[model samples]
Target: QIVRAGAPYYLPAKIAEHVSMVGELLQFPRLVPKKVISVGSPVKWANSCDARGCANLVTPSVIAQRYKLPDESLPAAHQAHTSNSMAVAEFQGQFWKKSDLDGFGTSCHRDVSVAKTIGDEEPHGGIESELDIEYIKAVAPEIPLTVIYNGQFSLLKWANQISSMADP
Candidate 1:
């Protein structure tokens, strides 16, 4: 029941027309947001979750020890970036679904691949971050997870391509 006409015109007939148009359009297919979970580095996870002590939740070293993964599977957990930190809050999924995600956009495409390292590679926030994976495994091992990453494309290039393809 949206009315585009203002008081200056105060045309009741026009308001009815606008309402009818809106009602008709409502019957068309509407886009509903999808929900997915992801993990990230301790600092990134903490900052995203706005939790102060997320780093302390878990580390790659802990995951390695718990799951018997190879020592080379992750960077040193004691590094300045991996030190004691708070765990990413569980409520992040809802926030992320509605958030612009620091201008990275809200859509997730399957075309990308997840990488083990962040060097020279396009940055992805979800499952691409190693610490994020470790935290997920540590906090909730029961939930199935799928990680995607693509090292060939830079973030800006990927965004540009998506934008261009969508343009008229």
Candidate 2:
């Protein structure tokens, strides 16, 4: 049995997609639907035995109860209501708003081109320079403009480097 009860951040859409793809590729005649059990309250161990690890099974509810989390704001404490899970085919949608950039300041929008080429320059101009501000202003008069950096890979590389330092 699969248990998917937690905050939306921990659940991703790719898991269900991958499972579907694998089943299709393998040509499974009948796919078995798995049971997804969501426990409303987090489980806590009564004894001090550490088989699976002390924190593994300890639910957010138990933490909230012990630490006294507010009842009205206990959605974060209630593990089952947080996560979206699929037993066989479907998956959960993105939890965060689709922003132009993530916390790392990487642009999510793709480059929009005008013509194939403009004034002997590439349509979007050189990478470092901003798009022709006056031309864009004339075309899109009302919109406030800002430059966004497409630096996802660089951010990831920096994150990896920082994470590696924690290794023994």
Top TM-score hit: 1
Worst 10 residues of 2 by lDDT: 86-95
Off by over 4 Å in 2: 1-14, 17-128, 151-168
Superposition error at 75 for model 1 (Å): 33
lDDT of predicted model 2: 0.30
Model 1: lDDT of residue 158: 40
Q: Model 2 — TM-score against the truth?
A: 0.16
Clashes of 2: 0
Question: Which regions of candidate 1 fall more than 4 Å away from where they truly are?
Answer: 1-129, 156-168
